[model samples]
Target: MDTLSSTVQAWAGSAFAAVFRGIKVVRPQRPIHPKGIQLVGTMQRDDGERQPSGIPWLDTAGTNRVEARLSRSLGLPDAFPDILGLAVRFTEQDRLSDMLLATTGPTGIGRFVLRLRRDAAAAVFSSMMPYKSDTGPVLIAARTIESPGKLPVDPAAFRSLLGGESWTLELHHATPLGAWTRFGTLTLKLAKHAEDTAERFDPVLNPLPTAGTYGWTKRLREPSYAVARGRG
Candidate 1:
C-alpha cells in the first residue's frame, strides 16, 4: 500500500487525524453518520442460481449472521430529507464482509458522475457500490421486498418496512462498465437495534469479497473513518 497512491493516502490520513483531534476537544469526531441505529440480522443466500464471479467469498454460498447500522447521512433527525445509510456486516468463520451504503436519491447513483474531492463530491453514489470480482468489477444494492425498482427510500417507509419485512441485496457484474447484471442475492432480514456499541464500519479494514482492487473507494473513505473512530 506504499505506492504514490499510498503516499497520498498517508497524507490524507494525517490531514484527517489533525481535524479529528481538533474536533475531539469539543463534539468528538464522528465525521459522518454520527447519528444512527445499529441492528442485528442474517444474510441468507437467494435460492436462485448465481453466475460465479470465481471469488470464493462471494460464490461460496450460505446464510450468515449480520450486524447492521442504519443512519442519516448528515446525522440528521429521523424525519429530515437527507440521504439514508445502510451498513451491513457479515462474518463467516473468521472472515468479514461489511458494506456501507448511502441512499443515492430517487434516481440512484446511476445518474451521478464520480467526482474526486475532499467532501461529499468524492462519495460514490450508485444504486449499488462496486467491488472487484474475478470476472471483473461488481456492485451490490439492497431493495425492500415491499417496493420494486424504487430507491433512496423514505424515512417513514424504511421504518415501516423494517418492522417485519426483509430486503434483498442484489449483486451485479459491471460489464461494459455500468451495465450491471444479476450475480447473486443476499437477503437482509429485518434489523433489530444493537445497544452500547461503538464499532465503526470501514471497508478498508477488510478484504474485498471478490477479485480486483477496491483501493480508490477505500482511499477516499479511510481518512473519514479514521477521523470518526478517533472520537473515542
Candidate 2:
C-alpha cells in the first residue's frame, strides 16, 4: 500500500484497538470465542517430498502435539446462526506455531462480512484472515472428507462433524509458490479445558516459519486481539 493508505490504516487500527479496550474494561472475560470447547490433538506434517519454501516451519516433516479449540464466533448459545472457528496451537523444539481458521471464504482480511452456518460435514474453513509470509501474503485452508450436505444448526451435529474424523489442513503459499500446499493432518482426540480465559488466540504470536500479519490483517484483527487482552 502507498504512504497515504498505510497511514490511514494505522490510524484506523489504533482507533479500533482503543474501542476494543474500552469494551474490555466492562466485560473482561468476553473473548472472540465466548462460547467454545477445547480439544487435544496432533498435527502430522506431510512427507519431506515437498520442495523447500524458505519458511523453516513448512520445510520439514514431523508430528507435533496440538491444542485445538472449537467455537462459535459469536459465543451464542446452540442452534443459532454463527460462524464456526478452529484455533490450533502446537509446539516444536519449544517454539509455538499457531493458526486460526473459520467457516468463511478464502482471500480476505475482513471479518463477519459473510455469515455461514456452523456446519461440520459441509463446512469449509479458511485462514479467512491473511498473513505476511516470508514469501508474501498467504492464507491457510482445510475441509472435511465428507461431501457437503445440508447445513446443520445444532451443536451436537457440528461437534460430530469436526471431532468424528481426521481431516487434512493446508497452508496456501502466495502466487509464485502455489495455492493450497499440504501443511498437515489434524486428528483431534478428546475434549479439554483451556484453563485460562484470559489467554486469547493471536496469530502474531505465531512461529517464525509461519509468522506475519500484513496491513489488512493488522488493521482488522490486531485491535480486536488487543481489546480482548485489555491492551487496547
Candidate 1 lDDT over residue span 144-207, tens digit each: 4332333323334544545554555554434324544454554554344443137777676754
Question: Model 2: per-residue lDDT, tens digit, 35-69?
Answer: 66666767777775764544666657777888876
Q: What lDDT score is found at residue 155 in candidate 2?
A: 45
User: Model 1 — TM-score against the truth?
Assistant: 0.67
Query: Model 2: clashing residue pairs?
Result: none
Question: Which has the greatest lDDT?
Answer: 2
Overall lDDT per candidate, in order of appearance: 0.54, 0.61
TM for every model, in the order presented, reads 0.67, 0.75
Off by over 4 Å in 1: 1-29, 47-49, 105-129, 147-161, 167-176, 189-197, 210-212
Candidate 2 structure lDDT: 0.61
